[model samples]
Each structure stands twice: as structure tokens, then as C-alpha cells.
Target: MYQAIVSPQEDKFIAVRAGQQAAMQLPSAFYAELADLTDSDGVVPDWFGDAARQAWGIELADLPIRDVLMVRAPSVLPVTYSRASWEINKGCNFSCEHCYLEQRPFAGLPLPEKLRLLDMLRDMGVIWFEITGGEPLIDQDFVPAYQRAYAAGMMMEILTNGSRLYRDELLQTFVVNPPHKITVSMYGASPETADALTQTRGAFKSAYRGMVAAAGVGLPVEVTLIITKHNVEELGEMRAIVRDLGLPFKEYGSISPTYTGKGTTLATQVPGLIGKSEVFQGCPAGHTSFHVDPNGFATMCKVGRDNPISLIAESPQGLMRLPAIADAQMLRTGGCSGCKLSATCRVCRPMARVYQEAKAPLNHYCQHGMKEEP
Candidate 1:
């Protein structure tokens, strides 16, 4: 794999080849994208943007120039996936209030079918799998699915609320085979609060016990907290708890509305989050990253829920054609075309229905001037 290390301080770009910094510089073609990337303040410091513009003939001369663009590998890289995430089933033991997934019947793939899908994923060039679910441990065929993927030479990860990891077979399987990481979600800092949040009595103790037990076996473990009003003040304490468990790292994310694509839980969102005003990138679906439901339907992301890229419907040859299909479907059209703030706008048509109060393309949560396009 070739790696181009770009320095924000200077135009110094070097490509790493064969584990060494190859004498080759980033080919001149990547400069403009690189510059626009660094100048997120909407300010291009130097002629890098210009060089990129002239080289690439960027029509949005309105966009930027001579900058050294970073040619990032797409999610669908030749030999590896940027990422792949899936929920084997919606069956979870601990029910949390902020959960995006509502339960469907336990209709996940069977073990043989799962192995077939795993083989298909390997064929499709997925390098790793982030296997998550209502609780992946609750899924009957999870271990077989995981082991199959691993045997097929793919890296694997599991996301759980941590209730069932302490099981001997699971603990040993992970200790011996090991995953890239096992990320556990901590609902709250204390037993009462955590259990209260999950609506499952004793779930907090079970989760912590699983974390401790997994770490005791030397498996890589991480804990993440989804910031919500209920646990907002307990962030530091949660970090401390994870630290006490001696997990490798901790992370946090903002609470999102229920993910059934209905935005039914939109009212539960914590507005106090200090969010960034970052601009839009391209559609993540059907491209760099993809999500597979238990049913083998694929999409660029779990959110859009629009175009269904049915994995079972496609042959291996058909799967290769997906990137183009994804790229074509990723465009923003109509009112989204000429909007200057399109870069910063968060609302898209799919989630627009979630925040369906306003029928316009504007983001209903906009504290900025995004409501009305000038």
C-alpha cells in the first residue's frame, strides 16, 4: 500500500513505499485537494490551491487552486475496506432509552448462511468487519460468523453493551483469536444510573464485569459513552470508571435520534453539544464505507436508508460495479446544487423526513443562516 503523508505546515508531501519514505513526492496531481482540505476556515493560505486548480481544471475556480490535494484511498480500496459495519440482529438484552434500533424478530442469518456471507465479504475485498447488534452476544450464530470471517483472513471487531462477554467460550475465543478491538458502550458511570439508563436492573454490574473479565484475559478493550442529558454531567466519572477497568482507551459521541430513520426520538437529542460547523463531504454510502443489515442488504451508510444495495442480489461481478452506482447516487441536486452553505449544511433528503417539521431542504436544527438559502 502507498501512503502519502501530507504536512499541513508546508507543501512537503512524501510517499511511503515499501516501509520507507520513498524519495517520490506526492504526484503533483494531489495538491489542490490537499490545500482545500487544510484551509477549512475557507481561507487558502498560498498558491497550492492555484496549482491544483490549473492541474485539475477545477470548475469551481470558486472552489480553490494550486493546492496539493490529498488523494485519499476510497473506502473501496483495491485490497482492503476503509470500514464495514453490520448488525447481525436487533436482539439485545439491555434496552437503553437512547437506542436507535428498535427490535425486529430474531431473523438474522443462519450460521451456514452467515459463513456464506462472510465468504462473499472476503470476495468483495472487505479487510475488516465491525460486527455489532442489539447485542451481538445474544445473536445465536455470532461466534460462527465471527470465526468464519476471521478464518477467511478478515479482521473483526465486536460492539456490545457488555452484558455477555464474560462467557468462557467467548472470552477464550477472543483471547486466543483476538479481534481488532472490542468496544463496550457504558450507559452511565454508576450501577444505579447505568441500569436506570439501560432500563435493565443489574446490567451495569454485568457490563462492568464483562469489561473486567475481557481485560483480564488480555483482549483489547475500549469503552465509549454516548453523551446524553442523563449522563452529560457524568462524563469524567465514566472515564474514570473505564480507567479503573484498565481498558486501553475511551471515546464519546453525541446522542442521535432513533435510527429506524423515523427521527422518533429527535426530542431526546441533547442540544448543548458543542458541535463543529464542518462542511459536507461526499456521500459516505456505497463508497468508502457500507452497512449490512442481518438480511444482507447493503447501503453506503446506515442513515440514508435510501438506495438498497442488495448483496445477495448481486454476483461477485455485480459487487465490483457498486462504486460507480454509489458515486452516481451520492450527488446533491436541485436546491442543493448552488447553495454556498451546502458545504456546511447538515440536512439531507433522507434525514429531512426525520426532522419533517419543515418541508424545505433547510436543516431544522440550524442555529446558523442555513434555513433560507440566499
Candidate 2:
């Protein structure tokens, strides 16, 4: 019979081998026990009834609980989607000093190529599609590309600076067909700081207006604050603003050091910009998600997007063989090994590369617990 072991450290359930038998090879005893725990009519405990309902998504009253449990078998493969973020364009109108893509070369996949990539994602059963860039909205293909994915039954997410979302009509379109989530990069709370960082006068006002417009359309919005030396102290203040706006807050500790464009100069100017907390262990790129650049190069993280993994060929098995296809097993070492705060840690491959390149150890800018670490 299979034994359910609850991980004391992570609050997760794992099935282990029991009685010299593989968990899968065990007889119906395990399922029988589960059925007994979920049975009604005073046979199973009430507490276990709820647990069984959650795990199996079946109401006890709906079926012969014992017989159903015995006959039904759970799939061996875990239920998860291949998470991918596509950089639709490499150009941005705003030039934020802290931007990893600012002043970098602008490139975009041709329309035909983009469509092919979408088909590939659909075929691979990638339920989640994140469209980002220097600014994805700037691309002429943004609307069409989004529609393509939406038609393909994929849930979409977008990351933008909120500059191009100026008109009510554009905002309305997003509301009518809302994506899973929309994240806006808020450079600063005030126009002065924002303009200074973006190196664009009056751009902050446009961005703010865009965010307000987006909110009016009933689209769920999240504010992403990129923390830097110039804005680290204002994080709490930024959180307050996000709360006031009725939006979720997603704070990035710092820009990745491996990022081309203004990142190189910014890192040099702001030494110790990153927080020193080793909240996360190693890179969680492949484990949780993957990134695809405009050129169709897939990688474990955005920083590594330019470095090619295998190309997006038309086969699932071939795609799985790509070096950038991050799996849970691949992320168990290096920065993630024995990490005390792995649950709350955000250190991914990009951040680790930044830490290694900038400092011998993890950078203070990106860590939560190592704020005072040398």
C-alpha cells in the first residue's frame, strides 16, 4: 500500500514506497483506506471527508465513494503547464536607467514566425503565456499575437511599463478579453523620480494615466516595483501606493547584473544596490517557468534568453531535450541547495548570474535575508 508522507519542512504531500512494494504497485488497500476515510453515513471521519474531497475533487454524496475510489486511478504525470514568457519586441520608448533592455538592440519575431511559435506552445500544452519585452505593447503585432493565443485556449499574462496603454478603447479591449494577470512596472511613486529613472520627461504621467485607465476597465492589475538604490528606501511607500490603487504588489529586489543595456553601468554606479538576503537558494528558472526571446531562443531565464538552448522545433520530445528546459531536479543545487528560506526566496538563474558576475557571493541587492551581509 502507498503511504502518504507529509513533508514537515515544506507542507507538501509525497507518496512513498511501503511494505517492499512500489507505491504504484500496491494493491487497492491504499485506495480502500482513502475511500474509508472519505465515506459518509458514519463510516468515515468527518475531518478526512473534507481532505478527500480536496485531493480528489469529488463530493462524497455524488457517488458510491468506496467503489469509485477503488476503480478510479490518478494519472502518474503531475498536472502542470509548461510556463513560458515570450519577448515580443526588444524596443522600448522609455529608457529607464535601471532597465535591462534599455538602449539594447530592438528585434521582433516576424509575424509568420510568431504565429508558428504560438502553435508550438499550444501543441506543447503550455497553458500559461507571458508576453513581455522592452514593451510588448509597442509591437504592432501585440493585439494580433494576443488574439492568436487567446483563440488557441491559452491563458495570457503581460508585463508592460504602462506607457502605451493611453486610450480608453485600448483599455476596454483588455477588459473585454482579460488575461490571467497584467503587471505594470512602476518606476517610482512620483513623476520626478520616474522621469529621472526613465530619462524621459513627462513619461511618468503617461504611465500613471495608463495604469488608471487599465484599472477602470476591470482588468486585474499588479504593480511591479524594481528596487534600486535610488528607490529601495521607498519600497514601503510604493507598497502603500499599490494598496491605495487596489492592486497587488510584486517587488523585484534589483535588476539582473547579466542583463545587457544600461544594467552594466547601473550596477557599477550602485555598488551594494542589491539586498544581501539569501532568501532563495539556486535558480528557479526551469523549475517554475521558462523564457522565449523574440528570435525563438528558449532559456531558463530572461538573462539567458540570448544564449540559445535548442531551437523551438516542432516536436515535444525535442523541445524537452533543450538545455534551457528547466526541471525541478535541475534546480536542487548551487544557490538552491540547503537554502533555509527556499519557500520565500526569489533568487532565480538571472539573479544568481548577476551575483556571480558582480560579487563572488550573492549580491545584497537581490537577497532578502542578507541585507547586511558583506
Candidate 3:
């Protein structure tokens, strides 16, 4: 039986997946007719959102049409990803003390290999590509890798440190075919403080020059501030610096210590500024988005970079099954069990791995809600 459901945003018919069966596009008239027959409760039912493909054993031709707007169809929803972050390389020119990669090697697949990986992502229907790295622009293969993504009609978001963007060659390449947007991380307000934080000479100047050059070239630019003790005192001034740049600005206060799940390197940050309950809200990792490390292992996000499924081994065929893959990796554990903070908790499988050794999941990972040592 055809059950009609209207789109929450508009008076449009909701799309239904026929699954392995024939594809079905329930017409608007179907919904209107169904509404006339069924009891109308003005509110849109919760099941409306969960609706997907029609169930098995129900022959499409034989089933009679029902005149109810909200027909109970067993939702066999398919998982489709709209955005993906590709950590092209783990290499960076500068050695920022708090780098989540924790000074991991600057290694990655060669240009030809990376392009093949990009092909897999494109075929799998990833609409948005967030090209990130230890610092993407500095990588030797970045230009070619980016060129391939642009050619594929993917909306590309570049995450860079702004160290190399000032060069005329790099600037020209970007101008030739610009990205959707470039997000630059603002380390410090002054050259001395910034260089000190980056632990490299002339880093602040180079990064600043590159950021400004991108803006001058008319490429969309965005700056984000990483709140660390090294630069926390100058937060006001840092915001002012980005403000003068006349571009969008964002602030990130949380610092995850271990870049990879292997080591216990602390990427320290400001104390008690952000509360635990305030921070551990629901995460969209498996739900709406996911990330890929330099090695092509896909995970829900960088925070929990473990149990990454190999993109190389699985694509188009297996990659199309990400919804099931993500659902199976659903993040929940005894650590969060019985805690009042569970309702709004964003702690997931990756984070659980982060503090697995410490055995104090919430206190170790969360900036707030510090519990005393046992």
C-alpha cells in the first residue's frame, strides 16, 4: 500500500527508496489524496523522518493505494554521506607543540595513488571534500590532489596553516581554480608569540603573509583560533587580528592530547573555561559525517581515530554501505553508563580509546567535570 508523507520543509512529497525493488517517487497527488482519507493531526509524525524504502513481501503492483498521509512504512533507510574530510598527509613544515598529529611523520600516498582514492570518494557520492592535513598546502602533492578534486565537481574546503599561501606560485594556482573556502589556523597574535608557539623561526610572518595574500587574491578566507595556554592570554588580540583581516573567524578551545591513539602526548589548553557537561553534547560522527586519516583509514572523526575502515579495500561497493558500517560502530560504553551527563554526551568509541588506559573516560577526555584520582 502506498502511504503518503509530506515534506516537513514544504508541501512536497517525501522521496521513498524502493531498495532492491523498483524505485518509487510518490507523487504529490498521492499525498493529497491520502491526507483526505486519513485522520489529520496537524503535527508531522516522528516516523515521517525515519521513512525510507518500502518493505519486502509487499508486491508493488498488487498492494492497494491507501488514502492516509502518514502511512506506517518500515523504514529501511539508506545511509548517504554529504561531507568527508580527507587527511591527505600527516606532514607539516612547522612543529606546533599542541598539534593533534603530535609531530607525526609527513607521509602519504603519491599523487597517482591519491587521485585514485579521490576517484573512490567521488563515485561514492561525497558532495563535500574537506582537504586537511598536518598542513595540506605544504605537501608536495597538494596542488595536483586539489586539482583532481576540483575537476570532479566536488565542493572543496581546504584546511591549511597559511604558511605557504603567500608564495606567488601557490597563490596563482589557487586563483586559477579556487576552492569553496580556505580555513587558516591563527596560532598567535604577534610574530614572537606565534613563532614561539609554532617552535619555528619566521613562522608567524610567513603564515600571516600567506593568509593575507589569499584574502587579497579574492579567495574566500576563514581564520580559526586555537585556545592554548601559550596564547590564551592574547585571545582578545588574536580575535582582533582576524577582525582586521576582514574575514570570518572561529574559536576552538578544546585540545585532544594524543594525535594517534598510540601515544599520550598532551595538547594542553586553558583550564575550566569550558565545562564538561557543556562540551560533551551529542556528536554527528557516524550520524552525519566521518573522517579519513593520512593512511586512508576512515573513522567517525579525528578525536576517535581508531578502527578505521580501509577506503582502498572498500569503495563504491563496500563504501556504499557506510550507513550500516557507521551504525555498527555506534559509540556507547559502560564508562558513560548511569552518568547524568549521558543524555548530552558527545563521548564516543574513539574518545573511549583515548582514555582507555586512564580508565577515567569523562574526566580525562572532558575539559570540565574533573574527578579526583582514585
Candidate 4:
């Protein structure tokens, strides 16, 4: 006997395992046809034989199968869970010249407020939650919030400047219940570069120590380098540091030209970083993830928080309205449509603001747009 099942796209032939061949009473022709179809030179891959046996408990040799072609409709909703970021605090201990979170002061959400929001998120089936701030650890309520979120079954991630994660207690907590991942922004090559970028003398040392501490606790760490005019030429050095530390790092070509923090003098001193052509463009915010400001307002991306789509409220009804807001913004002129590189671009809202302010064409960053091929 032969059994056939239809998948969403094609037909699948199932066969009985070796010992069950006699028990199943399958015909000899069934086994021969299956063998012919699944032979080494046959259309199906050899691995499929094993897969069919495991899935259907039938040997490919005993199952005769045919795959019928079918047209499949595109899925309406995306498959994976959408990610949402929450700005737990706006204040940072180190003020980097290119800091996008420059508008707000450093502070953690109140304990009561944080708990309420976590509960709401849990009820909404939010699996990915990122806790960020000037330095999220700076907030006294940080550890409790992490514990609560973990208990609620949320896979948490933290984005930090990495200066305050060196405490032994914090390191142990991270090891005990590590977030899905932690991103530490590596400022520069040496103490001077780190200090110059952060405007804090000991920040680089602290951040390096934090990375080592996190590693000791067996937590996975990813390093991020914000490439700017000052650091653009040091990509090789940065890569070496990542290799030496045995950590993963990504270089985000500088997306912001205006420094939002206190060190306006240093911010103005650095020249143009990457040109517009170098930035990959598609706004994947609504498609994959989104950012929520400290005040609970939803923004398309984390960089630009001034324009909000909706507020994160206590009720589920309010949260449901977010997609429409994202859709509306996405259709607008300056949101994701202006750039020629929009299809491949990782353009964020903050970068959009810079282009709007300068009244520059899609290529806001001159170097990326104008550089000659090496």
C-alpha cells in the first residue's frame, strides 16, 4: 500500500520503514516505484528518502509518490513576531557626539510604571523587548524590570554604552538570566578616542571592563561601532578588537550628522562621515520592529522620536492601533520613498530628520554618495 499527502505547494509520497514493510503489506510495485523516483539520479534529493521515513514512518522504497504543482497565495501577515523597543531611560553617563537619544535627560521609568507596561506587553504577546536608555543600568529599577520581563516570558535585549555593566552583582544577574543579547557600543581605538567620543575620561576603560565581565558571566555580547568621520578609517582596527574579544560587532555607517547631546562643540568638529550611497535603505521598522519613546509614543524608528503614531496605553485596543499609524507614515513622501537606495537602505528617522533639515537630496552623507571605487 502507498500513502500520499498533499502539502500547501506540492504532493508528498510517504513510505514505510524497513521492518514495517511486511507488516504494512505494501505491494512490490509500490516499493519499486518509490525506489525509482528516489534513486541517486532521480529528481528528488537523497535526503528526502530519510526525511519521508522519519516523518511518515514509511521507507521511501515502499511509498510511491508524486508532487503536483500548485499556485500558492502570498501570506497576508508576516510570519515572525514583530519586535518593539522601549526607551526605559533617556539619560546616559557618557555623552557621545553622535548620540541620537540626546533630547532627553537620563532617568529610569518609575517602578510602578515599568511593571504596568511589562504586564501590558506580556498580555499582548510581545516576545522581543529591548530596554535602552542613556545607560539603562543607571536606573535603580533596571534589574527588577529585567527580572519581571523574563518572568513574563519576554526575550529581552539591552543596548548600552557599556560603561555601567561592570558591577559583579549585575554580571551575575546577566549570567543567571542572560537577555537574548546585549549590544555595547565601542567608541574608539584607545582611551583617548573613547574619551573624546564619550567626553568621559574613564568611559572606554569601563566599557572594556564591562565586556570582559559580561563574558566571565557567560553572556553573549555584540559590539556596535558608530562609524563617523573620526572613526571611519579605523574599521580594520575595530574589526581586530572584535576578533580579539571574541565578540560580534556591526559597523553602522554614521546616520546622524547633528549631535543631540551636550557636546555640541565636538559634534560640530567632526566632518562628513559616509555619503548617502553607502547607507542601505529600506525602512524595515513596521515590517520587523519598531521603537517606543520613553513617554510611550510609537515612532517608526528609534532615531526620530518627535513624530509619534500612537501612545502605549493600558488597554489592548490602543496598542492595536499602532500598525495603521506605521502604514500611514510609510506611505508619506519623506518617510521611506525619497531615496534611490531605499530598497537596500537602513535609513532611520533621525537620518531622515537630518536630510529634511539640510534640504539635501536623498544622498545626505556626501562621502558615501560621492566616493570613488577603490
Clashing residue pairs found in predicted model 3 = 34-67, 91-106, 166-210, 304-350
lDDT of 1 by residue, 1-374 (tens): 11122321112343221112123345445544554554563433344334434543433233332232223322232323345788788788887787877554567777776777777676555654789887888888888787776654445678998899899989977765557678889888888888877889999889988988998888778788766667777888988888887775555544445555445444445554523334445465566567788888776566655556666666334445556656654565544455565556665544434434323223333424333334
| lDDT sort, best first | 3, 1, 2, 4
lDDT of each: 0.61, 0.59, 0.64, 0.59
> TM-scores of all models?
0.70, 0.66, 0.71, 0.67
Q: Best-fitting candidate, measured by TM-score? A: 3
User: Between prediction 3 and prediction 4, which has the larger TM-score?
Assistant: 3
Task: Name model 3 segments beyond 4 Å from true.
Answer: 1-80, 261-267, 276-281, 320-325, 346-349, 356-374
Comparing 1 with 3 on lDDT, the higher-scoring candidate is 3
Q: Lowest summed lDDT over 10 consecutive residues: which window, candidate 3?
A: 1-10
- TM-score computed on alpha carbons, candidate 4: 0.67
Model 1 scores worst on lDDT over the 10 consecutive residues at 1-10
Q: Candidate 2 — what's its lDDT?
A: 0.59
On lDDT, the leading prediction is 3
What C-alpha lDDT does candidate 1 achieve relative to the native structure?
A: 0.61
lDDT of 2 by residue, 264-289 (tens): 53542235544434455555565445
Mind sharing the TM-score for model 3? 0.71
Ranking by TM-score: 3, 1, 4, 2
Error of 3 at 66 (Å): 43
